[model samples]
Target: MTIHSISARRANRSAEARVADQGWRELASELNNHGCAVMEKLLSPEECAGIAALYPHEEHFRSHVHMARHGFGKGEYRYFRYPLPDLIGALRTALYPRLAEVANDWNERLGLAQRYPADHAAFLKQCHDNGQTRPTPLLLQYGPGDFNCLHQDLYGDLAFPLQVAILLSEPGRDFTGGEFVLTEQRPRMQSRAEVVPLTQGDAVVFAVHNRPVQGTKGHYRVNLRHGVSRLRSGMRHTVGIIFHDAK
Candidate 1:
């Protein structure tokens, strides 16, 4: 790509981000009340397709995992290499600061010792210093009957509390039956299941491992795991943004 092209794209992304930033306060409120929150059409359809099209490009990814082989489910995904795509990287950079505040608040509420840095770059540097240098952002693809198992994206010693997944394909048109699923486990309580609604270019910000929940006594920790249901028809593609790195 030409230097001018790159510069223009960056400018465009910055402009769009200014708009997204307006929703942060509301998003934070929703996340605190619910374990997850859906942001509508965070990316344009063309941008969504641009990301999905990268799934088959071997040069962009460092590693691929077959979910069935690892008992993770029936689909597959590939982790981005050191240099993520422009859009993916931009999304990560734009989303992190807002999320860090919520994460830190959760940490305080749960009395956790670790605190997130003010920005994504600083947090990533900490990960790198700890020998967790692998990029964790990934592209997932699923076809008929394919699904993802419930799990957290805790790759290394360090883990960010929040992560996001953007749906690249339109539901009902590009695929059906597969829904974003989040399960929360509360102490001595039955697991609660939530199927998040999403559309193409839409994204859901959710807890990576755990979140704080209010109880009669006080705030307590509740474990969270995310996955996808079976795809009844067509194919599905999603972009997962994980702020932390892997060992």
Candidate 2:
């Protein structure tokens, strides 16, 4: 099917059904209460299989392996560097439309269209203002035994708080080692962290910065320092979608 068809189908999904399927309201409530929210089983098994099939293990091993700091200790971890093939196919065909819908929905929720219109306009203008620049999609893959360091997704002045990951592997079957962890606060006395063990078709939504609330002083903050734990079992696979350039 065409990308347009996929997007139309995704969009035609009733809001109530989407909420029921993804627990979107609960997630939104969690985000309101905290800085992040996790929704389980956001995608179907068939969709997960389709995404997984897009990335062959042999091909991934040949092209996307790399080393990065896995934890605070001396040792490093193996990571799949780029899984763009499947992601590109998904983006051009399926992901963007869903992402756009999410973006629009979130924009409405946060009233970002009114608050950050100038910033958004300026950013988009800057992207288009430059003659040689063309907006590009970023795709990063992770596999078993691989891990990423705790860091924010910020590059220069162009940064966005929202990000999405499409899970491609089965929870217990594919690989069991990589778990996405997020720190709630950093360098604070009462700081805490949470490890989100997500299954196929699940996604995590989080804020990159804290918005000030009336009663609390920095009580609700966005701690975007996130990383993955080492993969120990079967190989884990995921495709990340980001709007800004990966530096």
Total backbone collisions for each predicted model = 0, 5
Which residue ranges in model 2 land beyond 4 Å of their true spot?
Answer: 1-24, 56-114, 117-140, 209-222, 245-247
lDDT (CA) for every model shown?
0.90, 0.51
Candidate 2: Cα lDDT at 119: 34
lDDT of 1 by residue, 201-220 (tens): 88999999989988888889
Off by over 4 Å in 1: 1-12, 15-19
Model 1's TM-score against the true structure: 0.95
> Lowest lDDT 10-mer window, candidate 2?
73-82
TM-scores of the models, in the order given: 0.95, 0.62
Return the lDDT, model 1, position 170: 98
Q: With candidate 1 superimposed using the best TM-score fit, by how many Å does residue 96's alpha carbon deviate from the native?
A: 0.3
Q: Pick the candidate with the highest TM-score.
A: 1
Q: Candidate 2, 87: how far from true, in Å?
A: 9.3
